[model samples]
Target: MRVLITGVAGFIGMHLALQLLQRGDEVVGIDNFNDYYDVRLKESRLQRVVDADTAGKFTFIRLDLADRAGMAKLFAEEGLDAVVNLAAQAGVRYSIENPLAYIDSNLVGFGHILEGCRHNGVKHLVYASSSSVYGANESMPFSVHDNVDHPLSLYAASKKANELMAHTYSHLYNLPTTGLRFFTVYGPWSRPDMAMFKFTQAILAGQPIDVFNYGKHRRDFTYIDDIVEGVIRTLDHTARPNPEWSGMKPDPGTSKAPWRVYNIGNQNPVELMDYIRAIEEALGKKAELNLLPLQPGDVPDTYADVDALVQDVDYRPSMSVDEGTRRFVQWYREYYKV
Candidate 1:
């Protein structure tokens, strides 16, 4: 399969690209290498992907998703068999600072992706969504069938908006669009901005770590391999119109159109402090904790009900936090030459 994976320089995208390449799939990936956190880190990830090309199986483009004309040209040229969109301006706190970035990337960029997929005769479009969409909903183990209308943060709103837009395209053009709402994902090559990475770095450096929600938060921290596995399986299964969908009692999750949403998560929520402790234990150090209130747009907890994903794809994100953190810290130390 000729797969176009956007954000191939990202943590998850790079991993997925490696798996796709290892499986003998021809892959074309795009990433603007935005300095959202560290462009160097992104470049390092890109390097790994480029280096792993034993058969010259992967090609890359330094393109921004917001550039419609640029993306349209690539789309017309590639004749893509499938699209996996992982690019976006991600970060809830950062969204509060620059909301326009979210609009540009998550909203405008996603629109371009949909357009490209539609015009290119793509078979299936598998895009990244977030568990943040289940904002303000005090529900345990959020299910795909649940309503995600009330997103607390701009980032969450953008993700929810993507699902809606994808459904519109699916309904209009019969595009098979599947939105995967990933929970707290962490592992090797993890983004430095994420909690697990930050905690590990801080603990090792003897820096104070900010414990959000006064360490009362819980998250279903999933490992990267499990995430990639779920993605690969979903890529094989194109979206299908829900036979049980009714306009009279319409479901926000499933559609009369060829649209579906699934939560890709561990299905096991762990406390925030425990997650920090996992990292601490991995590094054999204790973090200087500065317990703080949960910031605005930050949910107190996230638990994903992946039964629908398991039923559809027969996959689950089951890596324990301790084991996952161990892998992450090992990678961090080696990657940083610490």
Candidate 2:
């Protein structure tokens, strides 16, 4: 299948592109290469994708999702079989500082994607959602069926809006759309702003690492490979209407239309302190902790219920935090020569 992956220079996008290329799928990837964190890291990821495309199956384009004309032109020209919409301004805390970024990228940009998929005869539209949507809902294991009307941040609200936008397209156009609510995704080639990467960097530099919420936050840190696998599986399995869905008791995860949402997570929540210990173990260096209060727009804990994912995809994330951290630390050392 020929796939169009937005944010192709992103951590998950790059990894997903390589996997698709390796499996003999033609890929057209696009990214704006914004200076959110480090453009060099994004460029390196794209370069890796290019190097892996020995069969000439991958193409990279410099494009932003917010550019309506550019996105329309690419969609009309590419003749894509499927689209994985992964491009968005992706930091939860950053949204507090720059709310407009989320509106432009996540809301307006995603509208363009929906229009493209609706018109282009794309069989499946698989997009990324987030665990942060479960804000203020003290549910133990966050389930897609639960109501997510109380989002704490603009970023979370934008993601929830994406799911709503996709469902509208699905119902109106019979488009098969699936939204994967990703947990705290971490592994090699991760974003520098993420906790794992920052902690590692600070620990190696002998600097104090800020422990948010006084090290009380728990997260379901799903590995990148696991997330990629789940995404690929979901992309292949085009969403279908649930026959049993009733309007009387509407299920948030599924609808009468060809739209569905699933939580793609490890289903294992780890405390912040334990996760830090894993990093310390990986690098053989102790981190000086500066305990801090939880910042605004932050959740105390997040745990995903991935039973729907397992049932539909026949896959479960098996990577433990310890092993995943070790692999990331190894990659970090090699990537930076530290």
Candidate 3:
């Protein structure tokens, strides 16, 4: 399969690209390499992808997703079999600070991806949505079928809009589209802005860690490998119309068209303090805590019900927070020579 992955320099994108390459798939990846976090980390991830391409089956292009002409040209020329759209302006708090960034990358850029897939005859389009889309809904285990019409942040709103836009394309063009609503993803090479990364950095630097929601918030912390596996499985299984779908009783997760959404998560929710304890145990250091209230646009908990993913893909996430945190700390120590 010839796959194009946008945001190849991103945390999940880089991991997914390497996995595909290992399986002998031709991968064409593009990333604008913006300064959302650290450009050097992005560069290093890209370099790793380049180095791992022993079969010379991987290609990297420095392009932004919002660039209409560039995205169209690439899609037209590459003859891509599938596309995994991972590029977006992530972070709920960041969206509040810079809402325009989300508009350009998540909204406008996603439009370009949909257009590219629509015109180029791409068989499958798997894009990243967020568990945050379950905004304001007090559901215990957030399901794909749940209503996600109320988004707290622009980031979540953009992701929801992407799902709607993808459904439109799928209905009109018969394009297969799958949106994976990812939970809290954490592992080696994670974005510096994420809680796990920030907590680790601060703890290692002997600084105090800000405990959000007074360490009461819970999240379904999923490992990186599990996410990549779910993505590959979904990519292999093209979206199909739900025969049972009806207009009178609509399912937000599935449509009459070739469109679907699934929650790719561990299905295990961990308390914020418990997660911090895992990190502390991994590093063999106690963290100085600055307990604080939850920030704006942040949810108190996120627990994904991945029943559809398990039933469809025959896969389940097995990594525990303890083991995942240990691996990440090991990677951080090695990478930083600490």
Candidate 4:
């Protein structure tokens, strides 16, 4: 299949693109290489992908999702068989500082994607949503069927909006759309803004690491490889209308139209302190602690109920937090020569 993957230089996007290319699929990747994080990291990831593609099954294009005209032209020419959109303004606390970034990248950019897929006869459209959409619910294990109308941040709201927008296209154009609500995704080549990256960096630098929520927060920190696996499975399994869906008691996860949502996460939730400990153990360096309160637009916990994903894809994430963290630290040390 010829697949178009947005945000190809991103952590998850790069992994997904490489996996697709390895499995004998033609992959076209696009990224603006924005300064939201370190552009050098993005470049390094893209370089790895290019080097790994010995079969020459991959193509990389520098493009922004917000450029409507450029997106339209690309879609017209690419003849895409499927699309995996992982691009967005990704940080929750960053949303509190710059809300417009979320609007431009998450909302307007998603609009262009929906339009592109609608016109190009794309068979499957799998995109990234967030576990943060379950904001203020206080649910032990956040489920796709749960109500997510009360998002705390603009980032979460924009993800929810993307789900709604995709449903519209699915209903009107018979486009098969699937939204994967990702939990705390972490691994090698992760964004510098993420907690795992920051914690690892501070520990290696002999600086104090800020432990948020006083190290009480628990997260279903999904591994990057597991996320890419779920994404590929969902992309293959084109969404279909839920025959048992009812209008009287509507399920937020599935629709009568070809639209569905699943939680892509490691079902195991790990405490923040334990996660930090893993980093310390991996690097053999104890971190100086600065215990801090949870920042705005942040949740105390996130545990994804991936039952829907298992039921549909017959797959579940199985990476332990310890193993995942060690791998991330290994990559960090090698990449930075720490």
Write one digit per residue (lDDT tens) for candidate 2, span 1-338: 99999999999999999999989999999999999999999999999999998998888889999999999999999999999999999998999999999999999999999999888889999999999999899978999989999999999999999999999999999999999999999999999999999999999999999999999999999999999999999999999999999999999999999999999999999999999999999999999999999999999999999989988889898899999999999999999999
Instruction: Return the lDDT, model 1, position 214.
Output: 94
lDDT tens digits, residue span 1-338, model 1: 99999999999999999999999999999999998888999999999999999899899999999999999999999879999999999999999999999999999999999999988899999999999999999878798887778899999999999999999999999999999999988899988889888887777788999988899999988899999999999999999999999989888778989999999999989998888878888898888999899899998999999888888888878788888888989999999887
Q: Which pairs of residues clash in candidate 3, taking residues 3 or more apart in a chain or in different chains?
A: none
User: Which TM-score value belongs to model 2?
Assistant: 0.99
Q: Candidate 4: worst 10 consecutive residues by lDDT?
A: 203-212
Off by more than 4 A, model 4: none
The lDDT for every candidate, in the order shown, is 0.92, 0.95, 0.95, 0.94
TM-score each candidate.
Answer: 0.99, 0.99, 0.99, 0.99
User: What local lDDT score does residue 56 receive in model 4, on the 0 to 100 scale?
Assistant: 84
Give the local distance difference test score of model 1.
0.92
**Model 4 Cα lDDT, one tens digit per residue, 1-338:** 99999999999999999899989999999999999889999999999989999998888889999999999999999999999999999989999999999999999999999999999999999999999999999977999999998999999999999999999999999999999999999999999999999998888788999888899999999999999999999999999999999999999999999999999989888999998889889989898999998888888999999999999999999999889988998898899998
Superpose all Cα atoms of candidate 3 onto the true structure and report the RMSD in Å to 1 decimal. 0.6
- Which regions of candidate 3 fall more than 4 Å away from where they truly are? none
Instruction: Give the better candidate number (2 or 4) by lDDT.
Output: 2
**Candidate 3 residue 177 C-alpha distance from true site, Å:** 0.1
